[model samples]
Target: MAPPVLVLCRLAPDTLAEFADRFRLLDFYASALPIHAFLAAVAADGDPPRVVLVFGGAPIRVGAELLDAVPSLRCIITISAGLNHIDLTECARRGVQVANAGGIYSADVADYAVGLLFDVLRHVSAGNRYVRRGLWTERGDFVPLGSRIGGKRVGIIGLGNIGSAVARRLEAFGCVVSYHSRRRKEDVPYAYFPSARELAASSDVLVVACALTAETRHIVDRGVLDALGERGVVVNVARGANVDEAELVRALADGRVAGAGLEVFENEPNMPPELMAMDNVVLTPHQAVFTPESMADMRRVVVANLEAFFAGEPLLTLVE
Candidate 1:
């Protein structure tokens, strides 16, 4: 008999079929009840699932209570690069191993970050709007001037895989790159700042690519925004909570900061109304990691980790 696996998020029908071939899949998304109620029913059934597969945007939360309900649960596999939604400490304490997508989306996200930066600097989206609205026909080629990307000082937060990829791409465009991480990376030649504010002070553009943790929540607050000053631009591909959204809105409204390119928001699928009216701001619906290549890579990593766990092999991409 195949091992029992609980699935807690929406996935492609083909992906579900693939998993079903290798495991006895218990799909929570297909259940009529809420996730907690479903888990309660499963717990009452007295045969706890041994593995759980989670995907991004799942409402099901893995906390101590949930873990306790599934006494036989040993592993969790998440198909996302970020693990902010998971309780790592609780999982560790309970001897429940956790695995993530393992940098599969890094290149795609980095490419999107650079694309956002370019859009902000060149006013690409705004220009398209101007053309579509017939403002160009009335104004006769008198659009506002855009800043040149070359020779700009770029500061990156979290010099991890995505950050490093962004740095490399920016370097090809003749932009000088510096970074701020939890600690300095010895291998990289880029200048390192001790804090976000310090990095913002020296950079013409600030790119946030860090992971969200307790220490990193609101890392790009008002102070850092102010240090970037009125002429500075911010491009965030990281978690929305990493930047204080209220403060960011205030700064943008008051012209304390020049502009922004955001792919994520504090409240997802619901962005601030003020940002909608701003021509200087460029917004995307958290699609930085949504490329077909990245999705395939993510599926591979997630499946590999699950297969490793079930086969009694060392798990790949173990969260630690």
Candidate 2:
């Protein structure tokens, strides 16, 4: 008989050993079949593994049939904090357990978010782009003007793990920090706003780090953008869904906001044409969690989820 199978859609090559060692110890998990092929394998095999350990870039339809086809699949674990890709409702209906890696690694992301803020505020990319294009000498002084980081009001959305981390970094620069979330956490020292609109209206810089949820999709619409005013800038390190893409393009194109820093887009891998044409925008390839340390830590959480499930123990980070 084949060893019991455990489905992991995709994992970094370096992360395989940790998972392999944990699974190798369990008789059923040791033989736990590995299926990296994705939905095709899920569809082809009628009987499913006892659990599915999802990672970055993992794609499963998670429709009614996804749970129906794998009756044996008792748990679904996603290694990332973002919930945009997973289907929570369907999983709940099927009584399948769910878990997500949350707060495992947020410091690096906070650093990157602040780096992008300073990168845009200081015109670091604009300066670099000019230098590389042979226009640095002519435009260096006036093209990308410098601004004082101190005494500026910084507004943050969704002050969770990553957001709190960002708040600390920004406060170190002597900026007055305010934020908006579903509710306030008594532990955080930052000022809290009742709504995002209020935060935007008063801020010099708006950093969006909210989760991608039904209520938060496109929370930063024209109203919020306009609230930030022409001198303000926006930085988004959260899901692309939180900001209105069309409105953002118009704002950047018309100089509504001073500038924008985008690390994630509404559509992954396909950035809008309007964004590419603008010079006031600094873009990143969804690499906020690309640091070697963050990746390893995230991988550990993923493997732990898998190992715990196979051992018939409690999951490390169950989302539902």
**Tens digit of lDDT per residue, candidate 1, span 141-255?**
8457899999999999999999999999999999999999999999999999999999999999999999999999999999999999999999999999999999999999999
Write one digit per residue (lDDT tens) for candidate 2, span 191-276.
89888889999999999998888999999999999999998889999988899998988888888898889998888888889888
Best by TM-score: 1
Per-candidate Cα lDDT values, in order, are 0.89, 0.78
TM-score of each: 0.97, 0.88
10 residues in a row with least lDDT, candidate 1: 41-50
Which stretches in model 1 have alpha-carbon errors above 4 Å?
44-47
